[model samples]
Target: MHNQIDQAAGLRKLKKNKPVRVIAITSGKGGVGKTNLSVNLGIAMAQKGQRVALLDADMGLANVDILLGLYPKFNLSHVLTGEKKFG
Candidate 1:
């Protein structure tokens, strides 16, 4: 199918670009350990001197900052609305 071909091409491009490894944790039920695992893993990687950026992509229900107890002046919404940059 065209979709499969496009996906294969995308994967090949990603392989050639040698981007950093990406991990995605998904689930169907709420209150699972997705956020917990992401935070702990990110912290552990940082403790090991690895650069890490943990993004909670739950657009409608993001709580990474809440769980970490940090208030961010800007968030994905701000970026999407052109009030902030993705950088």
Candidate 2:
């Protein structure tokens, strides 16, 4: 189990160090399809076998995970509340 964790960490490090371009989509207003674009972009990257982590930092209005229909066991709120570390 420890070996598997180490291997996964190594792979993540390799992916981060790889020469892959990153794109950030932003909008000044809500309901502007920004979330949709980000979701599709992330999906495309992952489909291409690239490592991706989509963070929704909208505070009270975050919806990236919701748009993707993913129910995370823990979110930024948990970390902000000191329930988790920035591992």
Candidate 3:
């Protein structure tokens, strides 16, 4: 169909293995849905076959691990305290 051709023509292939893109979700105050939104957004992107990394840089709460139900065996704190090394 002509519609299918038009839709296919509109698509341009992206360059593979380029530098990683980062999406930072930040807010001034606390107790909003920033963590929830960022977590879901990252999941959605990964589900669509796009590589995704969500860094929880919130210095105060540091609850992204909790939202993801992940209890990391080692965190940056461990690295900073010479308890673990980045490999």
lDDT of each: 0.77, 0.73, 0.69
TM-score of each: 0.70, 0.65, 0.65
Cα error of candidate 2 at position 77, Å: 1.8
Candidate 2 C-alpha lDDT tens digits along 1-87: 553323234336656777545577877887889888889989998999988878786788788888888887888777666566443
Which 10-residue window in model 2 sums to the lowest lDDT?
2-11
Number of the candidate with higher TM-score, 1 or 2: 1
Name every residue pair that clashes in candidate 3.
Answer: none
Encode model 3's per-residue lDDT on 8-70: one tens digit a residue: 121122224364565778788877789999999999999999977676766566888998999
Candidate with the greatest lDDT versus the true structure: 1
The model with the greater TM-score, 1 or 3, is 1
Once superposed on the true structure, which residue ranges of model 3 sit more than 4 Å away at CA?
Answer: 1-17, 79-87
Query: What TM-score would you give candidate 3 relative to the actual structure?
Result: 0.65
Q: Clashes in model 1: which pairs? A: none
